[model samples]
Target chain A: MLNEKIICAGFGGQGVMLMGQLISYAGMLEGKEVSWLPSYGPEMRGGTANCSVMVSERPIGSPVISDDATTAIIMNLPSLDKFEVDVATGGNIIINSSLIERKTKRDDLKAYYVPANDIAVELGNARVANMIMLGAYLELTKVVSVESVMTALKKIFGESKAHLMKINEDALAKGSESIKAQ
Target chain B: MAKVLMKGNEAIGAAAIKAGCRYFFGYPITPQNELPEYMSREMPKVGGVFLQAESEIAAINMVYGAAGAGARVMTSSSSPGIALKQEGITYIAGAELPCVIVNIVRGGPGLGGIQPSQSDYNQVTRGGGNGDYKLLVYAPANLQEMVDLMQEAFDAADFYRNPVMMVGDGMIGQMMEPIEFKDSVSRFDLPEKDWATTGTKGQRKPNIINSLALDPAELEKHNHKLQKKYDAMKENEVRYETYNMENAEVVIVAYGTTSRIVRNAINDLKEQSINVGLIRPITLWPFPEKAFDEVPAACKSLLSVEMSMGQMVDDIKIASNGRWPVSFYGRVGGMIPTPEAVMGKVKELIGGEK
Candidate 1:
């Protein structure tokens, strides 16, 4: 029962890989089995990028989440266009409303839209948009606790970048609040 | 032990360090860059040498040199790079040197793609290098296995005074999983390396490590010695795993990353009451031919599933020796067969539905 397959996709610079890693690391912190696989190639910044992340109680069979993604976090229009159909039936689709003007076409799945970029910018740091989406994912799925995620963030940022931790925390809170408001 | 999440490449690097390997010579390749990258960052801290060789050929020769000097050395690469190291590997084996080599296999015939593939089975097991020598090959199924095998690989190489290989696909290099590193594992008490090319300053005798022998009889004698070592490995080093094979009607043979997928297929088939079993080979060189001997009486057929174009199937056929109807299901060119597809193949082989 403790299994979740998530696909986070966006432009290369949208921190999709980091978002996937954070989820995987948080799952590991909580003693859950996890895997993170990125679509690696010559692609870099501004290129189509995505990562597959799995948090499960049992060992994962495949890291490549081809089609059975339980949730898809689309951070841009192109990402949504590319991965919207990959969401499993009765799955969830969380979209970044700021860049993704279009809505989900599927009727069977629940969709939540948050202006992650706008919220990050309003919170005074645009780099934390991925954190916003991650926060929304945590609130919706509860695969890992928010406390575990914050601890993982502290481990990642560590001493050098510890000053930006508060903004990321704010971004996460704003994301969860946006989901609750709807 | 505290478990930490790590990529397979990073785990291999860490395990190598823990196994007392102080020399690493390799070039960067896709899906396995994290290995050398980790070494580059950590080797300096341990006062070890991590050199990025100019090419795979140079890297392997450097391994030959370091191993000849009695240092635990390793070099890693993917398919194309491994191909380039064959000559050096052959030379190292001929000289009876000890070293570890890793091949994080990608799709190949020649730079085919950067995706995970088990197509290197023949290349790694059938001696891509020119020799009658066999490298003790270990195929790990997961990140933790990769780490554990790395430690064992170093010991095996040193104990046997031969090169040992750890073969995995790109998926094993790229995926992240939880792994716990143990302090140490049991190792054989190997003989003193009086054959090593260490400096002979007022020593008993100077040693030379070379593969060349002009006289055919001398060369043949050396080959016989290597064959003896290989025979001993065959008798003792075979490792494999069997799952749900107690009373199964069909057996599936797989290894490394493919075995996990086959396990998934087996789980699904169990739901349908098909009773499919799996034999996963951990050591590819010894081939675990004995595992095939214990097939259940009710088992009617054997299916070999791999991410290659029916390569490992040949070994299964050889091991089964035509006792049972053996079939092959595979995907090549960087493509991986899903669990459902493998189940479909099992259904086809089993004549559909119990």
Candidate 2:
């Protein structure tokens, strides 16, 4: 019964594509149908980049996420402004409060503002900010397991970048705890 | 290898290597740029050669040269680059060389936007090349299909000794999906290259490859030869898939990413008890014309959905042959049509019940 249509958006350096890929890879490992499509072309370098991800028990259709998403993971101010409207009514939006600095404008959505950058700074790795936001998302939805995400992380990092996994795992836990504590 | 996540561009390279392709010549273009990057990185590891030609024209001519020497060679580019390669593409076809050409299409009648689009339908299927030539064109909707068809493309090219074009929009090049590279069956009994220009050991006739037939009747004979190969391909290599077609009132025809969006609409329409079926053409050149015959007699309308302003609709119309009233819905210039939008079209076609 786990069918989630999600959009993850942020500044290009904020690792939103990685966030989308991790979910798709984890869902694939769990034998769920998954697809990740990014906003490509001229804006990939410094512009706001976003990716749509679908993980479902049934076959996925149309990787483009225009509206009615089950979740929208927002990592920056512009991302929230753009994607907040895409979330389905009564769906969840995990906002990166450290950078976004505002609330979800939609009252129907259940918003969880995780201080992802601040949490990453505390966790001693700035790049894991996206993982913190992802962690907060997993805690709320539980669509895919944290362990599966870790396995997917290991695969993505491969042997060369294996050293970074520990910090990312810790960031995920802290981000998850932020939601669980509330 | 276990299934892993890969972008469409990278997976295409992987499949080519699996298919025993040894030479890749390409010029960089957005969306498909990653494919040449993958080939440059992976081709050498397999002891194959990868070249980034100075331009698309040079790249495709390089393909013609390598393919003439009996190597499974390929070249890739986006819309404008593919347009640049047209002259060389026609030469390869005229010379009857077997090679693979990939067009990861972007929007254009000119230098259009860089987004997902199917605007190059006419460009690839109709072909921009000169003379009587038809390249075997394949339009894969997803990454998995891209890989499978990419491998098959090589076999089909070598089988018929004709050029094969593998096409996908920008979305098919950029999207990430988990794909497994299975040992797909080759459709043709791949014959030996008795025609290749490999240097004879002074033991056989030295092969000379040229597209020129100066005499009018000689050129006509050559055209008939190429046309015969195309006719054989049309007879044997048409591929398509049908979904939810039983007793449906509206049958939508589409290909590639547009077909994926249409599937979503069909699923949603089922909940409202308004049945819609899909005929997804996997091969664009052959156009899967016979698929129209499968439409239920109860069908009220035939719809052609595309990411362009109605290019393939003509093919559908020709295929259906006035069996039912044909309609079209499209969004061009890199704009993609959503499922909600497609469903709205279906409602307009068959309103309020069944």
Candidate 3:
């Protein structure tokens, strides 16, 4: 069982939901039970959108979650404010420093403010910021193998955007390196 | 044999491709829009046709046209958009076309809200369009069911040469869960499509797919034929699930996402030694009345929960047949009642009644 609950939240168009999908896919590829549930509605575009990705060795009981989140990736200020309190003690938070500036407020949980956007920009695509965060989370939590993430990304985007795989892989490597330096 | 976690909408889209569903026509609607977006991208890869129809009506008509041509076709929409497709649905049923229609329902009597709701129960089960026909409606509660039922729906529709529907609320369509497909099931390998309007080149005859029968007697015969098909579907295709009902005093009857919420309520009640269970109907049309017979023998009362105001409750009442006192507790217009709220109702129903 993966035995973890991960949430990624941000504005609708920020690829927050897709990041959750990637993690969920990677988890599934690793032979774990997983679910990805998005906060869906008209609000998904502008107001707020978040996805809950749960991976366990056993069949998941509820696709919906109430607390018990062990990992969070907040791409916006509102996402951080909303989910920070819910992060389990000794959990981890990966914040996209380009979009969010808040310092970690909780001493119990470890927080990493990765410059995901700047890394994505340096990689020549701001849209890949979500991939950067995913890469950082993978290195920090080791929830899934970097190989699986790479395979899942290729499986999802290879046919559509042929060039994105290399650019995004670079962004992911950058994310992993930044975390390693810390 | 690798599993992939995908949203309900994306899974449905992928399953359709895996099932050899080559023609897809749909318009954009919140909650379920991702389905079309997904189809748009994946269809081409599988040599399938994906079209963003101008409107729900157009999309459904395209389904009717494609189905008439011996093609496995599908169209999806939300509640309000589904209402627009009702006219086409009736035509499809009257024509006895084999196609799949997906309704990722949202709250509605009118343009309601975009939140998840099961308000389309009556419209879907009873044939939302103007007719005395019934669609073989399959209701999926989770993402795995969503994929498996879609494949079954396509098969069922083709088996009986009737229009089948995979009906679910927005939550079931939008949520994601782990799923895997064993081998590709091609729609092209189905029993010969003898009833299609394929070009007649020295063939037996040109099949004319139309709902109009001018003679009243002829129309009556057609209606009777459709009724017989509906009856057969009701007998063989009705599906449901029962959990911990042997010694239950209260049975929660719910479907789609509401059933999951009720399961949570049942768990909470079980902790306090309250005997509660659930009967989740997987097919809305068949209505799984036989399950209720077992429920009445054990449970004294029932709680019908849904995202609509007493829609499925009516079906529960009919199924229960006044044998056990039945009560309704639900939310409407996309307002999902929390488990705590639902548990409150369960406690009241158990406590308020002697």
The DockQ assigned to candidate 3 is 0.50
> Measured by TM-score, how close is model 1 to the native structure?
0.98
Q: State the C-alpha lDDT per candidate.
A: 0.90, 0.90, 0.84
Tens digit per residue, CA lDDT, model 3, A1-182: 35788989988788888888888888888888888888876553478889888888866656665565898899999999998887889999888899787787889988898998888888888888888888899889898888888888888886878777888788788888888988
lDDT score, candidate 1, position A161: 92
Model 3, residue A111: what's the lDDT?
88
Put the candidates in lDDT order, highest first: 2, 1, 3
TM-score, A chain, model 1:
0.97
Tens digits of per-residue lDDT for model 2, B283-319: 9988898888889998999999998988888899899
Task: In candidate 3, list every pair of residues with a backbone clash.
Answer: A1-A56, A1-A57, A2-A56, A2-A57
How far out, in Å, is residue A5 in model 1? Answer: 0.8
Q: What's the CA RMSD for each of the models? A: 1.2, 1.2, 4.0
| Better-scoring candidate (lDDT), 1 or 3 | 1
Residue B31 of model 2, lDDT score: 79
- Quote the chain B TM-score of every prediction: 0.98, 0.98, 0.95
Off by over 4 Å in 1: none
Candidate 1 residue lDDT tens string, B1-354:
887878889999999999999999999999799999999999989999999999999999999999999998999999999999999999999999999999999998988899899999999999898879899999999888888888789988988899999998888998888889988755677788888888989866789899999999999999999999999999988999999997888899999989988998899899998888899999999999999878986688999999998899889988988888888899987788889899898888778866
lDDT of 3 by residue, B275-296 (tens): 7889999998889998886674
